[model samples]
Target: MRHTRRRLTWRGTAFLVGAFAAACTLVNVVPHGTILERPFVVEGPVGETLDLSYAELTVTEVRTADTLESSFEQAVAGGTFLVVDATWRATDGYIVFAGAEVIDAEGRSFWATSRGGCAKGTNSQPGYAWRATYCFDVPRDALAGATLRLARGTHGEDDAGQRRDAVAVVDLGIGQHDVNELWDATEKISIEMPGFASAPATDAGGEG
Candidate 1:
């Protein structure tokens, strides 16, 4: 009976020690693991330029339109169309800006749509800024506190391509108060295809 008690006590102690070691490993490993996996996020408000290591990005304008017009196709929004105009200047030799998504205040994400000549992704060389417009069909609730995330890597499940890369996160500046007005407005936006910012379709040309 004494030997049996001793064996039980030893098993209990071993189990406790193994659990403590696992807890310590998690405490040391989890934080460092998350840090290494996180992207280097460059954040800024709309109309301000952010340096995202590989490129510079500026969200120039934000608007909602009932209709989108282009030379080839026209699209009407099922919900409201959120149009985001941005300028990107690559500092690296040649880069393709592949990831574009809008994250709302509630952490809901909306990917950019390619309807009506809108650009879902763009390519640039290290010379000048390229201007492009991205659009999303979102509900009225998503209009407030929406942010635009642009990156060289494409956003896949679990942020697959964006890991450990420099990413641009720009706020669209739409507040809760602006939601009703933006949603109610039935305006048409004349969107041009992605082009060099130095030469707009017509030259009001500001440095992008």
Candidate 2:
């Protein structure tokens, strides 16, 4: 009976050790980066509309310039001004989009500049689509492989407000060749104020 009890004790110890090893293996092997609370990113290119659960987002166009012009204000960029045209159609009630960032290929993020009458974020309702332009002052290296991310949450705290929400990500489709041409551009782009959706109209605007 003594020998039988000793064998049982050893078996129990071995079972616990095996269970711990399996747990450790799972912790190391599982993809921890893909957390369950992460945002659901809807990706697309320019001219394509993406349904982001809360609203419909589209990046209409992207242009580069050295200066930005509005009706009463003018602003210049030390690097280059990237004018992004976008439209949003709200699905639910009133929504305010505060998350807007231009993320480059090398993981560099540039925030929108409202200095040139560009919009930082947008507020819209569910009736129709409204357009806004977001301008980013970015270096030449950030033009290529850049994507625009928009969400209702603020850009602060590592997009903490956007967690577990649907965020829209649109590629600007810029290449290295395009970067040089854009960087050399000396043209001034006209900035428009935020307004409702117009006929056959799409939007562009962010703060400032």
Give me the candidate number with maximum lDDT. Answer: 1
Model 2 stretches astray by more than 4 angstroms = 1-33, 199-208
The residue-by-residue lDDT of candidate 2 on 1-208, one tens digit each, is 3444555577889999999999999988876446854789999989888988888887888999899999989999989999998888888889998999999999988999898899999899877778899999999888999999999887676677787889988989998778889899999999998776552323442221
Q: lDDT per model, in order?
A: 0.87, 0.86
After TM-score superposition, what is the CA distance of residue 98 in candidate 1 from its true location, in Å? 0.4
Error of 1 at 121 (Å): 0.6
Give the TM-scores of the predictions, in the order they appear.
Answer: 0.81, 0.80
Write candidate 1's Cα lDDT for 1-208 as tens digits.
3444455577889999999999999888786536867888899998788888888888888889999999999999988999998888888889999999999999999999999779999998877778999999888999899989999998888787899999989888898999999999899898899988864221344454
lDDT of candidate 1 at residue 67, scale 0 to 100: 92
